[model samples]
Target: MRLTSGPAHSLVQLDTIPLGDWRALCDRALEPNGYYLPDWEAAVNASARGRTDTSALCVWNDGPPARLIGLMPVTSLRRAYKVPLPALVSGHPYGTLCTPLVDRDLAEPAVTQLLQAARQAGARALLLRDVALEGAVMQAISSALAREGLKPRVLQSYSRACLDATGDGDDMLRDALGPKKLKELRRQRHRLAEHGPVSFDIARTPRQVALALEAFLELEASGWKGRRGTALIQHEGDAAFIRRAAPALAANSQCEVVTLRSGDTAVASGVVLRHQSRAFFFKLGVDERYAKYSPGVQLTIALTRHLCADPAIASADSTAAPDHPMINPIWRGRLVIGDVLLPLRARDPLVELIHAALAARRGALDVARRGVHILRGLRTR
Candidate 1:
C-alpha cells in the first residue's frame, strides 16, 4: 500500500507498512537493540492474546515510494484493565525497551509527524515508558512535543546499571567493584573451587546456545524466581518466546549464553542478546545451593571480563531493575530510563487524570522500593 503524503510527512499504520519495508527498516534504520528487531516484534504480536493488541504508527518522508523514517509500536487501552481513558503505550507485556525506530538525523520531523498522526488516530494519551532518557527516542520526543506546545510529564525515572564493554578489562573491574570487594569475591571463588573446578563458558554457536539454554532454564527454575513463579521457564509464553527467539539470534551471532559450572553441575547461567556493538544481559539464574560462594556474582564477573575483552562488544545493558542488589555494584555505569506521558488530544482532561493516577502509582512504588532498600541495608548490617 502506497502512503500519500501528509502536509509534512506520510503517515501509515504498521499493518499498512508495505511488504518488505519492515525488513528494510529493521536492517537499515534501527539501532542494534534486540527489542526493536522485527523478529522480536513479530514474536510479541504473535503472543499478544488477552492483554492488548499491538499497534504501531509509521512515519515517512514524502516520496512516491515514501522514505520510511520512524516507527513506534503502541497499544490501545480503552476502559480495559481498569484504565478509564483511551491510552497508547510503546511497550507490550513481553517486551523490555520502548525506543522508537527513527534515524537520529530525521528524528525531529519524524516525531512531529508521529505525534500528529497518533493524536488524529484517536490516541488519548501516548505512553512512552521504559525507554532511555538520553537515547534518540527520548530526545526527539521531548523536542517535538515541546515545540508542539505539549508538556510531557515524566511519570517515572531511574538509573539503570550497565557495563562499558569497550574499556580496559582490569581498570574497569577495579573501578566498578573496588580492590577489596574483588579480593573478597576472589576469596569466595576460591572457596567454591574447593568443591570442584569452577569454569565459565560463553556459548555462541547454535549447539552451544541450545545446550546452555536448557541448563539456564533449569537453573532459573530452581531459584527464588521459580518459587515466585516469575521465571521465564515458568511462563509458557515467555518460555516459548525464548525458545523461538534465541536460536534466530544465535544464527546471526547476536546471542550469547553464559554458564558457570562446578565440576559436572551447572551452578549459574545467563543469557545475553547482542546487536552490533551492544549487548543486553537478558536474564540469569543461580543454584540456591551455591549461594554461599556467590555463584551469580561469580558468573557476572566472568561475563564482565569476557565482554570487556571482546572487541565486538562496546557496551552491555544490565537489563536489570534500578537499584538491583546483584548488578548495581558490579556495573558502575548507569543509563537513564524514564516513562513520559504525552497528551494525545487537544486540551484533553482524560490525559491529565491518567497522568495523575500514574504519578501516584509511581510515587507509591518509589516509597516501597526505598523501604526495601532500607531493609536490605539493615539486614546487611
Candidate 2:
C-alpha cells in the first residue's frame, strides 16, 4: 500500500478495524509486544466492564486499493489537570508500553497522519504514558515530530529491568553472577531440595495450562500479594481477564506457564507471553513458606536456562520495574521507558501548559523520592 498524497487518515472505532488489517499492521510495526496484541487489547476491553471512550486512530493509503497502514488505540479523557481540556491516552492503565501499530517503511507519513487525525478529533494533547524511550514507537514519534516541526515534552523518563537472552542463558547468568555467587545459588537450590524433590515444569499444551493456571492463581494468592490484598483473585476483573486471555494465547502457542515444584507442591510459578522471537516474563509468584530458600529466584534461574536453550526465543523482557529487587540483579540489562506529552497540533497553548505542569510535577516527585532513598541508605550504612 503506497501513500499517494492527500488526506489518508481518520479516527475509527476499535471494533470497526478489520481483524486481518489490525493483525497485519501490528506485525508490521518494528516492535510488537504481547501487551499491544489485538487479543490482549480485547482482553483489556473485556475487563473494562463498560467504558465507552475507547477508539482507534487509523492511517491508511489513499490508493486505488485503500489499505490500513497504521493504528493507535486511544481513549478520551475529560477534565484533565482539573480543567475541561480533553486529552487522548494510548490504551488502558493496566496495559503498559502502548505504541502505534505502524509499518516502519511508512512510519513518518503514517505517524504524521495519525497525529493529525487525533488532533482533528478534538484531542488537545496525546498524553502517552509508560512509553519505551528507545522503542520503535518512540523513534517513529520523534521522527514524525521533527518532520512536522512539533516539539514533544517529556513528562518523565526511567529505566525498566529487562533480560537479553540472545546468548546462552547459562553463560549470561554466569557472567552476571560471578562464580562464587553462582556456587552459592547452586548451594541454595540444594538446600531447597532438602525439603523434597525439586523440579521445574513448563506447561504449553491447553490442558496443562488450564490446570496449572488454577495452581498459579492459588499460589499467587497464598503469597505476599494475597496478604497485601492485591492478588488476582482479589480483583475480579483482572482474574477474569487472565482466565480469558491466557487460554486464548495458549491456543495460539503464545503462552507458556512455568512452575518450580518441591515434590508435589508448587513453590514458584510464572507466566510467559511470546510473540515471534521475543518473550515477556509477564508475572510470577512465590510460596511464602519457602521464602528462606528463595524459590522465586530459583525458578527465574530455571526460566533463564530454558529461554536461553530455546532457539526460537531471542530475548526475554523482564517486564519488571526498573528497581525490582529480585529480577534486576538476575537480568542486569535495562529497557529505557518514559512518558512523553505530544501536542496534537503544531501550536496548542492548553496542551503546552498541561505538558509543562506534568513535567514539573514529575520532576519534583523524582527528586523527593531520591532524597528519601538517600536518607534510607545513610541510615542503613
Candidate 3:
C-alpha cells in the first residue's frame, strides 16, 4: 500500500516490491550493497527471523514506464529499536551492511524523495544501521539532508576489516602476514595436509553453490557455533533463508560458496557475495576438530588470494566485527560502518530524544553484560 499521496514515493511491504524495478535499481545503484539486492533481501524478508515485518520505502521516477530510483527496507522504530517512536530502522538482511539502493543517475532527487517518503510515513527520523559511514550513498544522503537544512547524525560507528584486492594476491598476503607469520601458517598447512591433499574450491554455478551450501551448513553446525546454538542450521528460518538465497544469487553470478577441503573432508567453508567491484565475506563455517591447523584462517588466506586474483574485484569487506581477531590480521584494510540517524524535519527534537534513548539502552546493555560476565566468573571461582 502507498504510504504517501505522491506517486513519486511510497512505503510498501517488502515482499510486495516489484522485482523488475528492484533489479533495475540495483543495476545502477549509487553504491552497491549485495545485502540489499532483490534476490538476497527478498529471501531475507520472507524467511529470516525478525524480518517479516519489513517494508520498503521506494522512490519512483514517473515515466511512461515508471522507474524505481531508490529503495530501503525498513521496520517500525518500536520493533527495530524498542523505542516506541515514530521512526524506522533499516531491516537486517543477514549481513552487517545495510546501505540502501539508489539509482546513480538520479541519486540526489532519489534521496530527497526517500526522506520525504519517510516523513509521509509519520516518522520523525530514520535510523540506518550498519551503513558505510564514508560510502557514496552516505554522501548522497548528506547532500540531500543539507538542502533541507538538516543533517544526518552518526549514532554509533566502528571500523571493520576489509581487503584491498587490487594488488597481486601473493604480494598482499606476504606483506600483511609477514615472513614469520606466513611461515607458521605454512607449517600449519603442511601439518594439516597430512590428512590428505588440501585444496581450495569455489562454487559459482547455481547447482554447484546449492550443493556446496549443504557442506557449509553441516560444517557450521559441527563447530562451536553449533554447540552455542547460534549456527544457521540451528534455526529453521535462517537455514531456509540461506538455502533460498544462495542459489538465486548464484544464478546471477553474484554469489559463491568457497570450500577448503582435506581430501574428501570439508574443513572450512564460507559464503561470499559480489556487487559491482566489491565482494563481501558473508560468513564462515569450520570444523573445529581442525582448529589446531587453523582451518578457518587457512581458508581465509585462500579466500584473500582468490579475491585478489579476480580482476573485477577491487575490494572485499570482511563483514566481521570490529577488531575481529580472525580476519583483522589477514585483511589489513578497514571500512567505517555506522548507525546514522536521518532527521525528517529540520532540528526535530524527536531526533535528539531518539539518540539519547539509544545511547541509554546501549549503556544499560553493556553494564548488564559485564554483570553477567562477573557473575559467571565468580561462580566458576
Best by lDDT: 3
- What's model 2's overall lDDT? 0.77
Work out the TM-score per prediction. 0.86, 0.88, 0.97
Misplaced by over 4 Å in model 2 are 1-7, 48-53, 63-66, 79-83, 93-95, 360-381
lDDT of 1: 0.76
Cα error, candidate 2, residue 145 (Å): 1.0
Give the per-residue lDDT digits (tens) of candidate 1, residues 126-186: 8887788787667777788777677777777899888988888778889988999999999
Off by over 4 Å in 3: 379-381
Instruction: Give a tens-digit lDDT track for model 3, residues 216-325.
Output: 99999998889889899899999999999999999999999999999999999999999989999999999988999999999999999999989999999999999999
What is the descending TM-score order? 3, 2, 1
Worst 10 residues of 2 by lDDT: 76-85
lDDT for 281 (candidate 1): 87
The positional error of residue 238 in candidate 1, measured at the CA in angstroms, is: 1.7
RMSD of every prediction: 4.2, 4.4, 1.4
Better of 1 and 2 by lDDT: 2
The digit string of per-residue lDDT tens for model 2 on 1-381 reads 111223587776676668777777766776766776666666766674442335778889776567777888777544223334557767653445666677867778788888888777777788776777888778888888887777777767778777777888888998888899889888888988988899999999877887788888998999889988877767778788778777777887888899999889899999888877778888898899989888899999999999888888888788787688988888888988777888766777888677666666667878999999999899999
Best-fitting candidate, scored by TM-score: 3
**lDDT accuracy of residue 90 in candidate 3:** 86
| Count of residue pairs whose backbone atoms collide, per candidate | 0, 0, 0
